[model samples]
Target: MLASLRQERILAAVRLHGAVRVADLVDELDVSDMTIRRDITELARAGLVRRVHGGAVGPDTGSRPAHEPGFEAKRSWATAEKQAIARLALTLVEPGQAIALSAGTTTHLLAHLVAADAALRPLTVVTNSLAAAEALHAAVTPAGLDVILTGGVRTPSDALVGPVADASLAQLRVDTAFLGVHGLDGDGLTTPNLLEAATDRALLAGAAHVVVLADHTKWGVVGLARIAPLDEVDTLVSDTQLTAEARRALDPLVGRVLLAPPDDPTPEPPLDPGAP
Candidate 1:
């Protein structure tokens, strides 16, 4: 195919899916890796697509570090991957344990799972997500689970963040915290909103263990505000789309990396943090 046609196809794929991996593009376009990389470079130079570590995302797909989209807009971006991560994260919860869910669509989904599971009864959940609090409140009955919502200013992503939220988090401790982040790269866990980042950090501080829930697309992207470093995370649950190279690089940064198959809900056994 002609270079123009190949580039057009690449742009179309990125726009349609919000992001496209270079390897997948090479296979779909029947071209060499170098050719796909060159095309992506050209498109990026033309401001047609934003290049990430191993792929490209649409120019307007919140690729910018400072770009912040409302929760509803982000909920539809990677529904399957988020669901897979949520399911894997659910396996980390134990009966009678207190947990915290930070504000994000992925964590919000996990909240729904926790609310429905009677086996996880007599549990306490603290969160800064209004959506998560609502899901837990409406889904569970007979007082098996306790839901606590922090008070603070709300962000576009439906997270309550500010000094109030931070203070509330500081007063309590949880067995685990499942954080949903905007990006997770060398700079660490991040979010576009600074206040939200501070609140997220408070969430991290109050948990005995921390699990970050992110999809493959968040691998290379960085956000405006830093939450916590990768070393602080006990485990990271992402979808199978996360490249093997990415996993190798990330393994040493965190305690362990768990890849949830997009179609498979079964989770890998939790690794003991003390295990070598």
Candidate 2:
């Protein structure tokens, strides 16, 4: 393929996925690694993309405010990776534990898994995600689960943010909190919305442990506001697509680093067989 065509394909991928690894591009374009690297470098120089350690992210992901896509749109970006991460996140939940789930597509996916798990009966779930709250509300068996939704202004991502949500989170404490972030890097977790960053911080404060659920694509992308530094995270559950260099960087800063297995062909089974 011509260099111009290859570059256009690279640009399209970065625009669609928010980030693209050179290795992935090399495979997809059937070109040498050096070829992809040169394309990424050229694109980065032209201000069309932002170069990272092993890949390139969309131009908007630099110091500027990222375009926060709606929850449904974000949901379509990484369905397999999110589902795998959500499945891995479920293992950390114990029966009868109060947990907090911050608003994001991945956390919303986990909420459904949580709702369907009969063994987690008598569980209390606090969240600022309208989608997650709705999922829990629809599937929760009577007297088996309690769902709490914070009151606050909603963001484009369906996250409740502002003083009301922060105050609500401040009053409650949970055994664990699963955070879905827009970006993560040496600087820490980040999001496009400033108010959402504050709300995420509040959620972090209320949890005994913090587990961030992010896919490979978010590894090097930075957003408008930082939520918290890497040291604040207790565990990070990501899909297998996460790079080795990222894992090495996270091992010391994060208490635990977990990579979810590749997606299973069969549907996920229930957490437990016993009824609530």
Q: Which stretches of candidate 1 lie over 4 Å from their true place?
A: 1-67, 140-142, 265-276
With candidate 1 superimposed using the best TM-score fit, by how many Å does residue 65's alpha carbon deviate from the native? 9.3
lDDT of 2 by residue, 55-138 (tens): 777886744434566676577666788889998899899988999999988898899899888887889999999888877886
- The lDDT values for all models are 0.83, 0.84
Q: Which has the greatest lDDT?
A: 2
Which one wins on TM-score? 2
Candidate 2 lDDT at 186 equals 82
Model 1 deviation from native, Cα RMSD in Å: 7.3
